[model samples]
Target: MHIIKYLRSLQIRPNFVKKISLIQARHLQTDVFETTKVKYKYPPVYDPYGPRPPPSEKVTQLADQIMALTAEERAQIGSALREVLKHPKLEKISTEGLDLSGPAAGDAAQAEEKKEEKTAFDVKLEKFDAAAKIKVIKEVRALTNLGLKEAKDLVEKAPAILKQGVTKEEAAVIIEKIKAAGGTAAME
Candidate 1:
């Protein structure tokens, strides 16, 4: 049984009544306590990506005027628009019909494939012989158009990149020059 029931059954006297009332008050507070979920509210906002409203009367009239144009006139307008918007993505917009589907997903895939084919190379300098350090410095200076001190510092830092974004033929020629100068180099 509850402690309050037990206390009441004991019938202790007026002296314990105050302590009994305090305990009952605490018990009553715990019993009356309830859990409730709190919901948060925010001000209304306009979402641009949501469904668009209908066109105005002026826009409808413009559309009707454009649609009433001759095929030749429409072709001329289409060519003029294509000239104005000279982008590969915009090329897919058809002037023959109202093609609202926009560019296909394959365009991004094709661009990724083209990017994967490496066309540029970086020339990296490996370690060089101590005796031919001057010649290596001169070679680096000639290749990078750097000052004498800058070139020497670069040569000191072995396994460093000398030049970037060079074509395959140019990279081969650079490697040959470095080899002749007694310094090892490779294309990255």
Candidate 2:
């Protein structure tokens, strides 16, 4: 028919085509247009400059200095640096003109001092012999149902009760108390 031919020949705008395709696709689950597959080719790379310098000037200077140094001199300098690193003294800088002392400074100093104080358990752990410490760790693990590492950590952290003088039975009681407190303990 002439009307049908005229309608087919008429150019439908892209927006109208898109709207109709979207509605048709949603209802029929069919895409209106077939996608075209495209393969891309990379553009050729260009090098503007020639090869760079062999070594940077700073690196070359460092290499030269190293080459110039005698082995003995290097060793002496290394030892001196190690000594300085091991024990560094803080030089007191006078802040008389500056008001640096405040609540934050006092709080920081207090925190540091508290960190330095040794706990009772820490002192006891320090006194434990290697064997006693091992036993304590094992016992703590058994009593608390904790892993080997955790038990060992506990024993190592509290060595006073893990000392050679302390009996296995006494250690068991301690482990029992820890278990009762909802913690793991080993007392074998």
Candidate 3:
């Protein structure tokens, strides 16, 4: 009989009132504490339980000394450090691998191989003195083996090749002969 009366008393106290009390407790727990002080310090990443490495005393002293330097001194030191980092020690590079190898090696060699072997040179008549134009024309005509009209046209053109593809020695000889003929010719 006493247990039945206690159960009846609990039912009358109400379920809604219990729910409100639980919500109020949760709200108080999540409430922001505006009066609490903020800190900037961070915890070290190293193991706190193990032995710590000795602090760098020299580094700290050096840092303090650096801090004591004037702005100009610091700037100079900074520029020096920058130069050291940015520019490495100069060393001689192989000149052979640079520009001197010419068209006889590597990519240039492949290109040369693809090209027909240079047996004869193409003589480019660049310019000739007006006084020696007729002489230059006759020289071009003799070198080219073209007909009279064709030779005349080629000479009138002013810029014409006297030969096709030749060796270096032959090309040099041709250029020298053309120079001797009072015409500016290049062996290509």
* Candidate whose lDDT is highest: 1
Which scores higher on lDDT, 1 or 2? 1
Residue 43, candidate 2: how far off, in angstroms?
66
Per-candidate TM-scores read 0.43, 0.20, 0.36
**Worst 10 contiguous positions by lDDT, candidate 2:** 118-127
lDDT comparison, 1 vs 3, better candidate: 1
lDDT of 1 by residue, 73-188 (tens): 98788668767888443446456755456557877776566565668999999889999999999999999999999999999989899999999899999999999999999999
Deviation of model 3 at 102, angstroms: 21
- Which lDDT tens digits does candidate 3 get at residues 35-78? 77788776676566787677699988989999999999998886
Model 3 alpha-carbon drift over 4 Å, by segment = 1-120
Per-residue accuracy of model 2 over 1-188 as CA lDDT, tens digit each: 34434544686565666676667567765454558789887447654665566998999998789778899877776668768789674478997866465648558877676564322321133334554555556655665578998767766665333323345566556655554433444433
Q: Judge candidate 2 against the unseen true structure and give its global Cα lDDT, from 0 to 1.
A: 0.57
Candidate scoring better on TM-score of 2 and 3? 3
Candidate 3 lDDT at 26 equals: 69
